[model samples]
Target: MGCGTSRPRLDDSDCNPATGSTRKSAAPITNITQSYQRARCSNTNPQRSRAIGRGGDAKPPSYEREDPRRPGQAVLNILKGGLALKREGTVNAFESCKHKRILVLIDDNHKMDRITKRAICSLASFILLIGHGYQCDMEFRWPGYNNNDSPKLGTAGSEMAKALQKLMDTKTWEDACEMIDANDKLQEVGLKTWVENQLKWKPSNDQFQFAEQYRHHLPGEAIRVANLKGNDTDEDLHRKLRVEARSIMAKHIAGWAANDIDRTHLMKLDTEARKKSERDQKLSSNLGFEYRKAMENYEREMHLGADGTPTLVILLVASPITKTEKDSIIDCQRNIMASLGTKVANGSRDAYAMQTVVFTKSMASANLKHFQDIDDAFKGHHDINDLTKVEETKFCKNGPSPELLAKIFNSNLSSIDKSELGERELYSQEILTDGKGDIQWPSHEDVMRTFRPDDGDSDSEG
Candidate 1:
């Protein structure tokens, strides 16, 4: 029979035509050999088939096989002109547009310089390309960014396009470093890695809420580096970013400390603020007409006016203790504030008051975001005793400065009675006291009475 055009083979038994390849004889082939053979065959296929099997390779299939784009070249062409680079290299170019924006996604751990260049270049190209082609938006997605497993683009296709335009135009490493270092999340995931990992994790509904809630607590640098797409196009966006970044860093650092330390710091901040406000409030009130009228009852208690301005001081405390115990401590502190409010008004003989009162909020918020930093301290099984040194130092550094206190007092002088003030105590007596009753000091009469306690009826009655 004549050779058929559809099928032709030299050996029917030994040759393997299963893959449409000419196998000289049946020989066990390794994986590498099989791959090479399949590629060779696919290349020799019809034009349509060849195009269909183009992206089969060891790395990601999206990488082109025959493209001439070199490493370090702008990948914008890939997104814009439907181009792909077969080689592995990084681009260090930057471009900008007058008013248009271009999205540039990259591996988060990629060098800041490189990312900056790509962003600038992409933006410039976007301005030019979109101007002529379509006047539309474009998105860039870096895979495996910020612990993300997949890829994502921005809603408006990367609002960072404009900011990047500015960054490239200015080319300020100092500014970039300042911003990056200030970021709380940047420290956690690292600068370039944030971008890459973000590719893996898409924003879910819950995750979006979570990010929004804690967004204010991150450092400016961290937020800028973490999410560059907050394109509000307002000057306040930068200010808000700066403030939020600082708050995030504070919260994160607090989390790194042990639960006790975290809780203590939170309590300290809240206590100090509340004390100042209470002092002002009680002082104001006392200085008011009501205090003037009530002071007639007690000359000693009449001097200072009541100050009742409410102040907000929130402290986030993370503790290793049971939640119930933490709640109890918080409750006790609140009760102290409540009790002090009454004592300030009634004029008990021994009723001494602080210009500011100690009211603490939970430290749970601060410690939650930065547990990794302080994990060692918390896990070492240290008790409250271990906290003395740290707390003392922290109190000295972070506690209200005498200058600030003076300012507050000076500002509210009308209500605050500075005359009765004495040496400041480091720890509140309220903290040490059990609050059940006053500690007793026995007298000589009591000593003799103990010996005379043999009177059964009298002793029983006592």
Candidate 2:
């Protein structure tokens, strides 16, 4: 209930949902990674956490965090305490729950009884570990079209890992920087400026080659997030961090993280409700009727206690998640089209609205540093195969290439050739013009025609 700054002790029984308990002796994450996690939770109560976050047509995240320290431990403690106390927060769409839209993942419409919630903090951890010089003892899995067809964290991880691996091969930060400066990869990538200017990464006094600020993620924490097969993500809690971490996140990842996390939480609530009623014999004719009813009950109760409970929908995705895929997910949610519901009949909406309130990491900390690099340095994050490369991969996925869609948009319906339009271009046209062969901007006459009052049926007539 109290989001205090006290963290879990090194020998404490940290609640790890993966193994059910953890024994890893950990430290305050040094920099970048650990700081990012703390930053995720700290933004939970703030009004402007996401004011400056991932953009360029990106959507806001769904879930939020409350704890200023260890997210996993904070949630476990709350679960240990109870869900009866207040945990209220907000996002762009959580209010839609009241309008009767229960957000669902509905992956490929495979009649999945299980819902998958995307933990952004979990994702941040996943993203943070890519090149932090630590190898996860487990395989971090992100399921795709199928198990074998899942997406990967892109070459950014291996790239960062390779760089850090070579860096760690050195005895100290100064030596590491020298090796990088003298290296071919540095020269080939032309990262000498980034290395010498952006990433000095001086070593900690403890003799580790890592930066004193490098918040080295715990190995157990890494593994817990790797395989998201269970409720391993600290659903009940979240993170926050220092300036450097906050600056990068604020300028970069926050928006997507919030949007995705909220969507994931709703997905989980639906799945859990179905699991609660999978054995019901009185299921209606609707395929997920029982699921709907179970969720209806959940909504009835959660909303009734809405005044007393804390609803958090915060997440930070930096893995195999992509702009193309993330957009599709939103279209499914906002009803632009049935991308995920292509096979399944989307004949009905959920019987309830989302009631969980998560304070989002939407706006960045208002008191951010006015550093030159903070704004343009991290924009390339949107392009990572998954967001893993810590040192930055391609120096912001900005260039002339991204403007092709806008170029396409400039063409009128009768102007461009249809057969040759690429898939993304097709999709862009689909949403904007709605596949109706024209992009319409309705005039006053159209609005009047749409909602014209029936003859003598107007209240004025009465």
Candidate 3:
């Protein structure tokens, strides 16, 4: 046999190369074993023939060798496929772009998922190593699954809801308390177990990472102590202080009460003070007084003359006075001027010089008699120097002619003479005059002679 030759199978009875024979032997297995040992010692391909004899498929040894570059190639293929999909446009350009964007997002998510898995695995490995009494920090980059089968996050609320519903239906306080306590304890245990399982690399079937959303925050003191070397940056410190301040502000706001008796009393006092101030302002700005002052100022500024002004701008009521009561009327005028002076300081020129005027029918009949009395009464009075003026006119009854009465009563002479002068009224009868200055008052005979009586009346009477 050659040194590098293959061993013969048990079915092939040709044991020696010098003689080839096919025969059934009692120790055929012995011959095959001897030949296999010899082939092994001679460095022949005995393993291939052995595999064939055992009904195993023969394969090249190169197939067992792992390619170190295969992972990189796979990553490249995936990237190329992604790019190809992106470049390939569809009839609906919007949907294509949207799909591409989603694909890119999915790719980024996959990368993040890989990184997260590696991080979790590293942490879990660290925990395991710590359990086995390892002291050094170890970083791992391999991915792992967390297959833990604990109750999912947020389920505690549902459980509480069920218990609360039961308590509402039954109205048992003790049972409700027990249920709450039990739920609290259950939540605490669940939290602890979940943390333990995460640290121990247990796999989870959840679609989302619960720890990602519901994180256990470390205490501020613990964080500060952990950062003994003052590694915290300025931004981090500011953020921490801001968060603390916001928390404090929130606590104060949550406990705030608007109905505090002291605060309410203070507010009432403030409101009363404001109202009093408004009232004082209103009293100070008296519209009537201000209006009078404004009118006086305007008249003084404009320098208006009596001819350009009205005889009476306003009418005021006054009692009729006799000529003997002239001093009393003058005193009243002085008082009115004083009141006008108090309301308006600059009373040099006003709509009314004396601010009041009194007129009586008897004074009008006496012409200048009552007028002189009024002037004399106010002449020496220091308060009514230029501030007062009095005037009188003829009375309607004692006028120079009946025209005065007509003007006073705003009526025709006929109507006035008939009402006041009686039967001796003017224009009582129709007068006829010719151009020769002869006038005649028609008597009843003349009027009857001018008009004939109706014939029908004359015939009916006789």
Candidate 4:
């Protein structure tokens, strides 16, 4: 909920869901891997449209939608079914009271006759108890096994103790009550005496006074009103009314305490909710700031100079690069520029400022050669080796080849700087002896004469 602001609508086809004719792959995509690949295409734009009869024979013909026979889809369906089975298994185990076994692991008996019957069929009996978290301790004894007489008692006791401990650690009274309420076999217990005892204690001393406030009903209050039977008298129904009132009150009280509900708890909850709201607001603000900051950084990366005038126009340049490749290349380029920061020769103040232009497919296609020239001037990212090393281990199951990548790079190089290279000198020669080399070296006088100004009449007057 506190994530970044919604981005502006770019285009219909740019979204993942909007991409046509793509099937969900078998292997799940890893977040780190996805991010790495995205670096290469960060500044590039998606290709507008596939060229007809070119670039892999104009998108393959649409096949009939595979039904229950589709390989990938079938695997996915099976996976979903497996997950469902696991959930069902967990529920079945709980209902059967499999958790009741082992000493000191008691379960609240449910009122449902069917559930208890099922548990009995499975040779399990749960002791009904109330309250939340670690409600009650149990001492379990197997039907055929004697705890005191058996030679394996110590081991059995230890195992049972550990099992119970684990169950109690995870189970709660609220969960127990919900489970018990689902059964019809268990009878509801009244809390009239318990409520009276609770009330007898001073409100100041009672730790659960806040919980009692909502739960404990005062004497003589009606639990529910209903039409009386024709033969039933007021006195006969009075006893029934009292039982119902106590049951209702007991249920409420049990629920409140079991859920850790109190005035203090409520106040704490309110405070937390308020803090979360404030945090969300702050997060939203931060996201806006980050977006602006990222844009500013991008601008500086593209523009070569600190001059405020925007040099690079935001364009829809076509990129053959995938998301993964884009992210990698961007990271590589960033690192390379950082390494060369001090070494790069700057003729003017503006020369040092460099901003990278993120382009879309349309922009790349509109002025492809010029952009390619610009790319060439930069000589491509030096970190191309890093990507190649990655490619050695990780192969794209479905993707364009590195040759295609190189082709895209070459094609885009024409759009960048137009320059020719001169023969590189390995080393400058030093004349140890004047006659050591056949090549004639310039004398000091010759060098001076070459640099001298032409003679003029004004110089003669001086």
| Model 1 TM-score relative to the real fold | 0.14
Instruction: Write down the TM-score of every candidate.
Output: 0.14, 0.17, 0.14, 0.14
What does the lDDT read for residue 398 in candidate 2? 12
* Candidate 4 ranges beyond 4 A from true positions: 1-366, 380-462
lDDT at 249 for candidate 2?
19
**Cα miss at 223, model 2 (Å)?**
50
Clashes in predicted model 3: 8
Of candidates 2 and 1, the better by TM-score: 2
Measured with C-alpha atoms, the lDDT of residue 358 in candidate 2 is: 15
Candidate with top TM-score is 2
C-alpha lDDT of residue 346 in model 2? 22
What is the per-residue lDDT of model 4 for residues 203-304, given as tens digits with 9 covering 90 to 100?
Answer: 433544553464356343321221122133433333333333322322121111212332233223323433433432211112122222323433354344
Best by lDDT: 1
* Residues forming the 10-long window of minimal summed lDDT in candidate 1: 381-390
The lDDT per prediction is 0.27, 0.25, 0.26, 0.25
- Candidates 1 and 3: which is better by TM-score? 1
Error of 3 at 372 (Å): 2.7
lDDT of 2 by residue, 1-462 (tens): 111112222221232221222343365443323333344434443333333232323333432333323323322222122212222222211122222212111211223311112222222221222111111111221111111111232354335435533442343445645765677654454445544323323232242344322335547665344223123222111111111111221111111121223223433433443343343212212212212222333333333442322221211212222334334333333342223223212211121121111112221223111111111122121110111111111111111111122121111111211113332321211111113211122222222222232423323310
Score candidate 3 by lDDT. Answer: 0.26
